[model samples]
Target chain A: MLKSNPGLALCILIAIGAICFALFSGDPYYVQVVIWVFANAALAVTLRFVLLIGELNIATAAFFGIGAYTTAVASTILGWPFFISLLAAPVIAGVISSLFGWITLRTKGPYFLLISFAFTEIVRLIYTKTEALGGNSGMIGMFPPMELDAYFPAIAISILAAILFGLYAAERSNLGRVFKAIKNNEDIPRSVGLNVIGLKILCLVIASTAVGLVGGVHAYTNSVIAPADFTYFVAVLALAYVKIGGEGHIVGPIIGATILTLAGQFLHSFGPYENIFYGAIIIGALLLVPGGIVGLGVRFKAGTLMGRAGR
Target chain B: MELQVQLLMNTLQIGSVYVLFALGLTLIFGVMKIVNFAHGTFFTAAALVVTSVMMWSVDTIGMPIWFSYLIAFVMALLVVCVIGFVVYFFGFKYVLKDLNGSFILSIGLLLLLNGTYLILYGGVPRSIPAVIPGNITILGASLTIQRLVLMIVAAIITLGLYILVHRTKLGLSLRAVAEDQEAAMLQGIPYRRVALYGFLIGATLAACAGALMATVTPVTTVIGDDFLVKAFIIIIIGGLGSVLGAILGGLLIALIESFGGYYFDPSTATLAMFVLVVILLIVRPQGILGHAEK
Candidate 1:
């Protein structure tokens, strides 16, 4: 029943549409936007993976920054190829995440969150203040991929969609069942003799690697890597995207990124009003639709349509 | 010796401001699990209120400096408290019912309040005219009377808060609610009312700090972001809910920034403080004052 679901059909349609939109837009400016949306979506999905285990790591931005800078510095200074730098980016980020998780995994809830945030701030501060790197003036003149001639946006979106679906499928598989069990009752997962710490750390590494990939692409696409781009606000925005779109499923990040990007474009001229709009949407969603749009759809079907059909 | 004295004074002044701000944040966090991202927005709002009032008094009405400061403080406090109450009722009610639910909602409120400030006030740093005219030398250290006044006011407020929390009936109720909300609700404490009071008190504290800070530093819409980070840092360092711990944490951060900046690069100093927070968490996650359960 699960293998032959209508949701899978919907997912495929959405993926195709997204890929088509990216390819056809043909605007250079829109290409940059696509890169940003995919990068953030990847990070949001990573956030979702951890959130499933009831944890919020506020350092996703820091890791993203780390990956971006690592790639930027390697390409700019060492004259490495884009693909090689991209490959190294996640390894660097994953190493940092592993060290951070080693220290912070024992602390629970808000304290854990605060410490992670501090870690992010430290990375940003180091990036900004180190004159040897760039100081407050920021890193400039990054190089983009040489191989890709056209349809970069489509490529990026397709890659991101592929990653999202990959993660979603993994979550639905037998391995995914372990993640659900861990989320349901952490102690029960432990009592069942599951390797909880190993599983969580593995998730963190995987998420960091995903973010690192996006960061590398972004660094190359933007031709710049500044400390300002990777602040606590970035992390919060990623979390917000996940929360507003829906935490329980992978499509939520896509929906969230799409909605926010569109909303941002429309309200771009309004300055802070855009944020107020974003915030209001978040608050309304949390209050009225805790399960998010997907959850709302489920409730509608179960409460009205399904009940009526039964009658 | 003179340089040492100057650094000490600067550290003390900045430390006091942070202590006041972080203490306010801790109070709310203690009672409500909500992070109150809007906590620092109140600081900015209060600063704006202080700035506008002081501007009107001096620039428009030509009032005395002393009177201007007093009026600014009161008006700012009143305005922020009202905002706090409104936030508690409108934004917080839903979030507080479910921890995860409110976190997202509060985040939205953070963006909204920040945007509101940006829209109302242009994104520029505006300073409050100093009330005291000149500096006075004390114990071989020259200090501005305005800085001294700020320190004194901060101390008095902190002490007043300490007494209020430990000695009063309302403070006791606040504590009860913080300890266990449902149990406190069972005692006919009216949890929502107490939560509102907590919000008001926290808002008032943060506002007062903002007003006081305006005298020392210029006010900008984005300044709240800096204060929010500092407050979150302090709350973590001092532990979540402990009053005494917040005071120590504030001072500790202040001293770290002061000495670290003096010894190393300013950026490195900031990074060090954050690194220390991570180290401290691994060593003792509960912080200087927080209990194990928290």
Candidate 2:
């Protein structure tokens, strides 16, 4: 069925899953877990947008933090409406992404990775060191600025769906094709008079904006924010979602986020040992199935599952 | 003038330890082209190893502090050497041919190592007793003997590394493999062994650094993250894949951070170093001494 009409099948499957999740959203724990998954999915998908362009950004969490803090400060400090504050999240993220992207995206590989990685540190440091930002204690007592609670899962689902669909739309658009072309060979387009840097910055804006929006939602959902929440671990974990879910398609983040988020719950009882479990799974996944669970499914579909699991 | 001397001493002490850590990283990266994200974990693990060994010997066996430190130092090296060997075999061997693959796998190694450390040690903080206590006042500035020794140790190691890389068979094999892996293989250079040797030596050096730093500061699992980032900035500004580059880079960063912290907020000291790296990359992404990619 997947091969027969992959797009149609995916749409139908998600519709059914979203409906079931929405029905169960009445439970606070269920809704919270679902929100966590959505927030992470948004982040992983945003990360995917750049990963599509063959750039690895480990700073999506920083942008996510930007959105969260912006929302927190706007709502609590300035008495802004949730809608207005939320809008500022992505706008702020886009502006920063463009500025930083222009400067850092000039380099690639480790250079690109390091600069992007530093972004999280800078943001975290600013938030931690600046007393106005609440420093290490962070800000709390947040609620969704609008009647988002009445809609609950509808709002959450819509946000997650919008990011996924936005990504889906991009995959089908000329921009996506250009992204692919750029990713495959930046020089090929450079010879053809394309503005490579502009496109790359565009990629950053879109990805950071999506992640930033989720950050606002994340703050709204949690009602508390801390610098510790947006660390190097979160960024790396988002990359894991993309890698293990399947980077080639939009479904990868969905699958990867769902499994890992659920797995996190399963291991919660283990306390500190939970990280050990997560680490082991990621290491095993990288060594044994670097292509991720989706790739494994694809391999199984074609009957080449044997002798190729260790790639 | 007193403050200036003290700050310079502080810079040298920190910079020396950083050189120890950064050189190991540059060595592995130079030969393998794999960024070991978990490079910091080795430092932490070695500290843990040294701390536990020293505590056990001093508390249980009633050994002297100096003798216990000696035992801890050798044991830490052995433990970290094993960790490096395991890392190379489990992480590097599989992704040897793929740069992107190694990068992703290294993150996994990092998470795995971090999680493992958390499980074993919990979040408790411990400190390694100073192996060489007491201070030597030099020109109206008092500095710990341990720190001054570390500076000299760093200088000696730098000279030793230069000699080893230039004058030894193992270094010849490593240089040959690094220069041209395919060509080296054709010439029957056991590049895999060279990689293993490099990783072990690098790990041993990192252990030395961890042991040294732990004496002066507290040993916490997360301490590695800060040092690792500094090492990264050092290699980035100094240029990756060169020993001399790491030394020079380490000192430059240490000085910037020391001065920056003294003049500004101490918490933003790393921010200063990070900003310097960004500006450096914008002007010269290949780093100060790194060869430009063809």
Candidate 3:
């Protein structure tokens, strides 16, 4: 079934390995890493969804926060079931980002970036200060639908797998082409009589919703949610995933996030020095592999990469 | 009434350092077309330099206060300029034409610089003693003499920068480069020299602000985070590439932050600024002094 695409095959094998590891692997640490990889993979793809339309969104944490918080509130405050809250999280996030997109997407580039930056801080402060949202105490005692230790991670990967498949389908569709057109030249899309704003909002909404769903998965996996979890640094780190993975390809973000997440595992003991390593990874990717790891793969295929065997 | 006067002084005291940063940030953007995320780190790093210099001079070398300050200021300027040039060479040169690449590169630079700073300085907030230890009371409001001196120094630098950008031959070349890189390059202006000088001068101004700030505020590795965000808002509201807009934007932010913080909570102050920037985006995307549409 996966013979036609090697990339799809790799994803399948990885998903299988993840499930097997979660089910049978003795080490909880590696299982957690697998789950973290999946969570970031979903985020990286969501970010790529927006980037596909040429928008430099630094607001991943904001929408993610919205998703996580909404789920927490729905589950705890409103006494909704985990399943319903999980579904509602992305919807709430999508609606919120729609409002944001309506206002801020009017501006482009750095202005868009700044507005997104502001949104994260604003959301964080509101959550931090608002008593209704538990203020600084945040929401705790989240029970996943399943009680098993591995259940949340399994569900998280399943959610991510679904998103990956959905994104894969979208990448081949006409809608993706419109996003690319907008990315390449907004004026061209406008000249073709496409509603540029509408298309952008579409991409933003889709990306926001997907990211929100991941945020829901995140809250359940950790069994607690806090405003601190979705800070600007986390958002920037998400952006770095897509950047270090590669641009202009679907698999780049997955590769980037997986590599970086695993690297984080090793660098965990580095403590304060971990950030320096992250910075070094990003800089190295930009300088040496502007195409990211996938780009390097593409180059090797094209026989342009030094000391690498070409197909 | 006393509160108002103190707030006014407070506005200028913070606004002066903010203006120094915003002006340098805008000038660098004008020349390089890349927003330096590490710009605030530059400010903090330079402040650290100034703080260390003063401590060494006053305690270790036992120099007179004025002489120590003089040495600190000059050395900080030289050191920061070199740092700026090195960043330009290593961090920025390859990605000069690629806006996104350069922006990400600078983001990496921010993390790298801030991390190095944290490890080196150990997260302890430090402050140099006031350049002059006297408080002047005006209208029943007491204000530190250091802040007053800082305002004057800020004025001198602003005036000097205004002269440098508007009057001198080098200024002409720099502005020409900003106007049109290719045309200026074709017109016999050395691109690297103009860019390097503009960047160095901007970095030096930040160094001056950092040094001056050492006398007023505690210096920490993470202190730059707030200023960097403020600089972005200032330049955006002031419009990118306009020094006057940076000045205006700086004052507007300082006022907003001060008045808003007083009237509301810290979150409200920041929240208000965020709202204003959003509204400005809809109404006047070019900013008050920026050219139409970035």
Candidate 4:
């Protein structure tokens, strides 16, 4: 499969290299940055996964938070074993997202968008209000087992990279086609006896589960989890990454996340100007490069081909 | 009886501003078919302008408090209107009827404008001294005179909007376009122009709410953002693009917030609102008065 798809091969190679670097790199800071890029990529990709059904799912942030919180609770409170605590993130996120999607997928467009946004905020509010979750200050002390400490970065990056590949594989499957069909017009899919709503829920569950796993990894990586980290703004930035990287392909968001996450490191010291910088980039991308970087490349390639044809 | 009356008063006071804010949001949704997340920025701009103008007029220029407030109110409206016009032309116009595009655009504007406000105003919250001092008893419930005026003015503006929407030529155009853009255009309505007017009207309503709110609450760069989540809940409950729905939704949410906050705690009130929204989605996804989504 990798031989047939050079792009897929390149992605795998990059993931392998990233894992190797995490394992061998001397600087913990750089390793931490690598974990963040993959985590963010997971977020942006999962967000775009829902976009397959043509709905903007802001609840991506909520589910990510849920995953983190679940792992946090399982590890810190219940004292669950490492793997069990980590695996609980996806299970809990999937269950909640399925329920969330089942109830909300009935309303599409603006209603769905607004409701998901409200859900994200409400979930964050719940965290801040609940004392066990550590409230506004959030929870800390989420450490991987001491034996696994040296390998945690590699572990985190590998799981996050797996999420990216797992989603890409799903997107290329027949189920992905059904999602696109539903987006084009649900009525047609329904006419064919497809359970449109169930498929949407499935789509959401798949994406949420992936994000939840990332959240679990995030819990271990950051060693601290807070309510503020999971604001709807998280989804907004993911959407920005999707837009700037070009949502036309799965790779777009990954690329966008990498660039922005790196840029963010430098932008950290700029104070209020950081937000202004991101805001400007989003607006500029929307107005100027509606398709993002990937889209621009496609247009450029098409233009060159046409020029050759004309010649 | 007094406690009930007091809660009712609280509901009306909170609901009045909510109505103004949600009306703009729903109106924009109706006319442009885009959610303006930056709607709060308009509110913040107006409130910021109000505080600055009030300080200048009352403190520096030595104007009377009431007179200075009037100046501040009008100036706030003007400033927001200009900001509204600039954004409408530069950004919102291109994204008309595009939901995700508009959402992203508004968010970007939200960040940019909010950042600018932060740099200009700093992080401190500012409150102007009351223009109208003293209190009055209504049904054995004591109320501040200033709050009473806010409710009255908000009511007047809301009523004026109702009349303008239902009784005027422009209102006909707005409703017609919102119902069906193609048909409205076929009937000779200038869709783009009407959308601009609707957007401006919505921004002005938010400005009015912000200006009025500045009188009661401390004004901060982020004051408008506090109202954003609640306003979304209000519109969702009221039904998107329905003026009446926004009004009813605003009041309903305020009632819940006031009574629930009073009976339980603030966080419980918020959670209760979310629970209510979930139940609403289950029972009537379109909202209390919202038209069924096509």
Candidate 5:
């Protein structure tokens, strides 16, 4: 089933569902959460770009933080409009991602992981240390959408869904196949005379922008921004969702994000148990269900139980 | 001159502590080829163990200050090793063959441990018993005896680790496992036993570092985050799967942090270490002591 490449059909379904939900849901909180899911999905799928290329770039949170902080600073400190900050957020994240790619992508394996992880820490530290970004306490008083019209939720979610759909489409295209090749066999890609580094940088930039846009929406929704929301925890959640849902498929992150977000929010009363549960889920998924929930379905249909068990 | 000496000592002390932290991380990577993010959680658990010992005062044994530390280290090591063993057996064992799968599993373990720490210890930072009596002034430079002892202990541990790696049969097996697990198994080396030993050693070193660091920085749920970051930097700058690289990386980062903290802002100093590491990684992707092995 996964071999058929159902990405386009999945995106259309998601788009229709998002619009319908916005149109019918009376509760603003519910609508807001949908927006949040979209934002997270976009970020997660974009993050898949690097992962698809076999790079464990764990700095999505950093780029997201940059976008969120940029929006906050641009809106409050510079008194820019929400729209302006939204546009600038991705640019800021993209620039930072470019610099990061230049310094990082040169290494392989755990070294590369460390480089990206350290980069996130630096971003977080800077976010916490700088008074301009609101220091350890984080920033507040972010500008909300200028027009809180009834269509805001629908429009925002639509735009997010569209951008995410674009990303999903791009990944399925010829360009994405090249990335998959690079991930599977780095030397093969290089041997074929592909500019591997350039492709990585391009993907990083594009993915960074997608994540940044989500961060921008995050800021506007809350009308406040802080370091805590854009943290390693968020990064973990995004990555976990991608892995648990199925990293190889676009719908995987979407499904993963929705389940985790809703579960995390509703079952939050269990306190830290949620984290433990989340951890267990990821580990279990990796160990017993490497193909994720979707992969399991595919395996079951084919009657390949053992194949399903292994990645 | 005195201040400079004091700074040098401080740098060495911090660097040594970092070395201790990175030692376990490097070992696990070296032997099992597993990047254990849960490594930091072991340190956190150790810090908590130290705190619990100070607060509860397990009176059945009744030992001296140094003996209590030894007991604390031992107790923490046992707890973390058991945890590590279970995680490795359940989550990591099967996933070990796949680097990506293992990476995700370790991260999950990290989250579980962090959550566990928060649940068991609370988010509040707890203090450990400061057993060292006083400070010693040498050539007009003042230093806490505990700090001095911790530094010595770190050096001793480093030397011991070096000896264990280079001088022992277990060390040879470890090197063998790291170089090629399949080949090592073909040579009749007990791969699992070596890996268990590696996990035990990693857990012990991490706990030891945590116990020592708790004396200086106290114990908190978030301590793992800071130490994890530092360890990552050390492992990267020093070189992945390289024991000596971890040592050198730890010291280099420590000196940079020490001097940077004084000369520049604390935040900038931290940033400097990462920036320098990133530059170094870009220049030599294999790290200072790391040789790319196929």
Candidate 6:
């Protein structure tokens, strides 16, 4: 498989390099940034995963929050072991997302979009209202065990990279083809005696579970999690990443996430102007480069090949 | 009895603004087939304009409060219309009937406009003096005269929209296009123009709500955003693109908020609304007045 797909091989090599850097680097700041890139790429990939079924799932943010909160509650409140607490994130997020998808998947297109948006907001409201979850101030103290302290960043990056690879693998499988068919027309898939809604729920569960794991890693990485952190805006940014990266393939979102996350570091000092910059970027990409950066690259390569043939 | 009357009055007051806001949202959705996530920005623009215009007219020019407010209200509507026209031409026109594209475009507009509002107006919440002061008692329920006027104006605007939609030639074209764009175009109706009109009318309704809301509450850069979530819920429950549904949904949500908030806490009331939405989705996913999806 690695011999056939050089792209996958390169990705694995990069992941190993990132993990090695995290393990060996003395500077924590750069390691944190690398972790953020992996985490955001996972988010963008998972978001695109659900788009396979033609629904804009804003609840991606909600499930991420759920994962974080589950880990937080398990570790801080229940005093579970580190690995178990982290494992609980995806489990809880997956279960809740299945239920959420069952109720919501019935509504397609704009209805699904609006309902998911509402779900994200309401989930955040629930977090704020529940005092045991730390309310508006949010929860803190999600540290890994001392022995794992230095290795936590490496571990987080590895898991996040694994999520990216796992999702990419799923996208290339038969299940992914079914999801594409559903997006093209659900009735066709249903006519085949397939459970259309069931597949949608599964798709949501897979993406949500991935994001949930990211959220769990995030909780430990940041050592704090807040209700404000999981707003519908999170999904919007993920969508931006998907758009900018070019959603034609899995690599687009990763590239988009890496560029934006790093740009975000520089934009931090600009105050409210940061939002304007992102807004401009989103609109510009939509109008000028609807295909995103990857799309542009594809067009360029195609043009050069055509020119050589013409000559 | 008095407490019930007070609650009823509160419901009507809140419901009126919601009806106007949701009507615009539904109307735009009906015509363009795109959700305008930046609809709240129209509301924000109007409220911000009202605040500035009121302050300039009253504080600087020393105009009388009521007259100054009338000018501010008109100015607010005008400014929102202009903004709507610019956005419709520059952005929304291209994304017509494209839901995801339009959603992203509107969000970009939301971030850009909101950021500009923050820079221009600062983060402080500003409130104007009540244009009409004093209180009145009706059925043993006391309400300020200003709030009473706000409700009256909102009701008048809502009724005017109802008449325009039902009785006018323009309204006929709007309904025609919304019902079936291709069929309407076959009938020689200009789909794009009608869509522009529908979008402007929707923005104006939001402007009306924002202008009225500024009279009662502090106008912040983000005041309009507070209504966005609830307005979405109202539109969803009422059914997308249904004017009457928006009206009914708005009133129904306000009724729930008023009574539920009174009975339980405000957060519980919000949770109750979400629960109600889930139940509604299970029963009638198309909404109470919405047509079944194709």
Model 4 chain B: lowest-lDDT 10 consecutive positions? B285-294
Better of 2 and 4 by DockQ: 4
Better of 3 and 4 by lDDT: 4
- Candidate 6 residues A93-199, lDDT tens each? 99999999989898988899999999999999999999999999999999999999989999999999999999998999999999999999999999989999999
lDDT of 5 by residue, B1-294 (tens): 888888899888998889988989899888878788888888888888887875655355566766787777777777777877787777766765466677788888887888888988797878766678799997788999989888998889989999999999999999999888999999999988898888789878988888888777778886866788888888988888899999999989888888889988788888998778867876788889988745
Weakest ten-residue segment in model 2 chain A by summed lDDT: A145-154
Candidate 3 Cα misplacement greater than 4 A, ranges: A1-3, A146-150, A307-311
- Poorly placed runs, candidate 4 (over 4 Å): A304-311
Looking at model 2, the pairs that clash are: none
RMSD, every candidate, angstroms? 3.0, 2.3, 2.4, 2.0, 2.6, 2.2
Ranking by TM-score: 4, 6, 3, 2, 5, 1
* TM-score of every model versus the real structure: 0.93, 0.95, 0.95, 0.98, 0.94, 0.98
Worst 10 residues of 6 chain A by lDDT: A302-311
- Fraction of true contacts retained by every candidate, in order, equals 0.77, 0.49, 0.49, 0.76, 0.91, 0.63
Error of 2 at B230 (Å): 1.3
Best by DockQ: 4
Ranked candidates (DockQ, high to low): 4, 6, 5, 1, 3, 2
Q: Arrange candidates, best lDDT first.
A: 4, 6, 3, 2, 5, 1
Specify the poorest-scoring 10-residue window by lDDT in model 3 chain B. B91-100
> Candidate 6 residues B1-294, lDDT tens each?
999999999999999999999999999999999988999999999999999998999999999999999999999999999999999998888889988889889999999999999999999999999899999999999999999999999999999999999899999999999999999999999999999999999999999999999999999998888898998999999999999999999999999999999989888888888898999999999999999999
The DockQ values of the predictions, listed in order, are 0.66, 0.61, 0.64, 0.85, 0.78, 0.79
Runs in model 6 lying further than 4 Å from the true structure: A304-311
lDDT of 2 by residue, A67-150 (tens): 889888988898888788878888888888888888888887776777677777778988999888899999997787455666
Please list the C-alpha lDDT of all candidates, in the order they appear: 0.79, 0.81, 0.83, 0.95, 0.81, 0.94
Query: What is candidate 2's TM-score for chain B alone?
Result: 0.95
What are the per-residue Cα lDDT tens digits for candidate 1 across A1-311? 54688887787777788778777775777666766676667878877877766777778888888888988888887778767876778889989888877778777677767777777877887887677668776676765555674665677677677767777877778767787787677788899898887777777777777777777767776777788998877878887788778876787876787677666777888767888888888777776666776665666867863443210
For model 4 chain A, where is the 10-residue window of minimal lDDT?
A302-311
